[model samples]
Target chain A: EAGVTQSPTHLIKTRGQQATLRCSPISGHTSVYWYQQALGLGLQFLLWYDEGEERNRGNFPPRFSGRQFPNYSSELNVNALELEDSALYLCASNDLGDYGYTFGSGTRLTVV
Target chain B: AQSVTQPDIHITVSEGASLELRCNYSYGATPYLFWYVQSPGQGLQLLLKYFSGDTLVQGIKGFEAEFKRSQSSFNLRKPSVHWSDAAEYFCAVGARSRGYQKVTFGIGTKLQVIP
Candidate 1:
């Protein structure tokens, strides 16, 4: 089975621009999550979506937003990106019935 | 809120030597614990998980972790280290929120193996 898949493995954006990263969950998975892995920041939860509904979100600015499609694929959008937004944004899926998440390789966003 | 802490930021072990990575968590109720490994430039892979039942659980690549309720800790261990084992290790605690499970990951412990 193909694990979670992320697009554009790496992305570069200018400061104050908008960036969108995409993720496709494994087959039959209904829940999708977004996380940010930055230098010194570690892995921080960003958002959670299940059944195409935003279930929960982390302690981030309103500029950080995302949504899940009916197919369970997810997109993370950062509006007016700052240099601090430069980080590896990882996407994970919840399907094992437990909380054990299968993560994608992640999209490395570099804000210049 | 649930939080996980990996005290060791980085560790270096010689090949064939034993290894142990410490992790501690704070949660109001019983915690669902997990250990994941991520190679540089790669995504995270599940090593093992413990929701309940056994205190000790075995995972991929000959890795194991023991959960201690009293200590509120879950530490990963390996009898013998391998060079390929060098990677960033993360510990996480899972909790339910809004009918979906939310996981909080540790700062991560980077392992360096000396051949």
Candidate 2:
């Protein structure tokens, strides 16, 4: 089975600009999660969407927001990007009630 | 709030040598545990997980982790290290309550293999 898929392997944006990253969950998966991995840092949770609802979010600012679509695909939007916003944004999916997650390769966002 | 700790920032091991990476967690209740590996420029990959029952859990790529409730620890181990095993590893904890589960990940440990 195909694992989670993300678009735009790499993205470059300037400070104060906005960026959008997309993810497509694995087939039959209902939960999509977003994570950010800054350079030399671990994955930091961003948001969680299940059944078309925003279930939870991390400590990130409101500028980091996203939503899940009816088809279970997801989009992460980062507004007012700063140099610190540069990171690899990952997307993961899992079946409802399942603990394991399959992650996407991630979009490498570079904010200048 | 739940948190995971991976004390080792980096570790070096020779090929064919046994390897162990430590992890500890702080949670109010029993937490689902997991280990994930990420090669450079790649996404994280699940190595193994422990929900309950057996303390020892085997995972892909010949990796395994042992959960110790007394220590509140889950350490990943490989009987024989391979050069390909060099990657960043993360330990995570998931709280299963309130009709949902929220996961928290560690800072990660980077493994270096010397051939």
Candidates in order: C-alpha RMSD to true structure = 1.1, 1.0
- Per-model lDDT: 0.94, 0.93
Model 1 reproduces a share of the real contacts of 0.88
Model 1, A4: alpha-carbon shift in Å? 0.3
* lDDT for position B16 in model 1: 100
Candidate 2: regions farther than 4 A off: none
Return the top candidate by DockQ.
1
TM-score of chain B of each: 0.98, 0.97
On residues B1-115, what C-alpha lDDT tens digit does candidate 2 reach at each position? 8999999999999999999999999998888999999999999999999998989999999999999999999999999999999999999999876777788889999999998
- Score residue A74 of candidate 1 by CA lDDT: 91
Model 1 ranges off by over 4 Å:
none
Evaluating just chain A, the predictions reach TM-scores of: 0.97, 0.97
Clashes of each: 0, 0
lDDT of 2 by residue, A1-112 (tens): 9899999999999999999999999999999999999977788889999999999898899999988999999999999999999999999999878996889999999998
Model 2 has a DockQ score of: 0.75
The residue-by-residue lDDT of candidate 1 on A1-112, one tens digit each, is: 9999999899999999999999999999899999999998999889988888888888999999988998889999999999999999999997736577999999999999
Please tell me how candidate 2 rates in CAPRI terms: medium
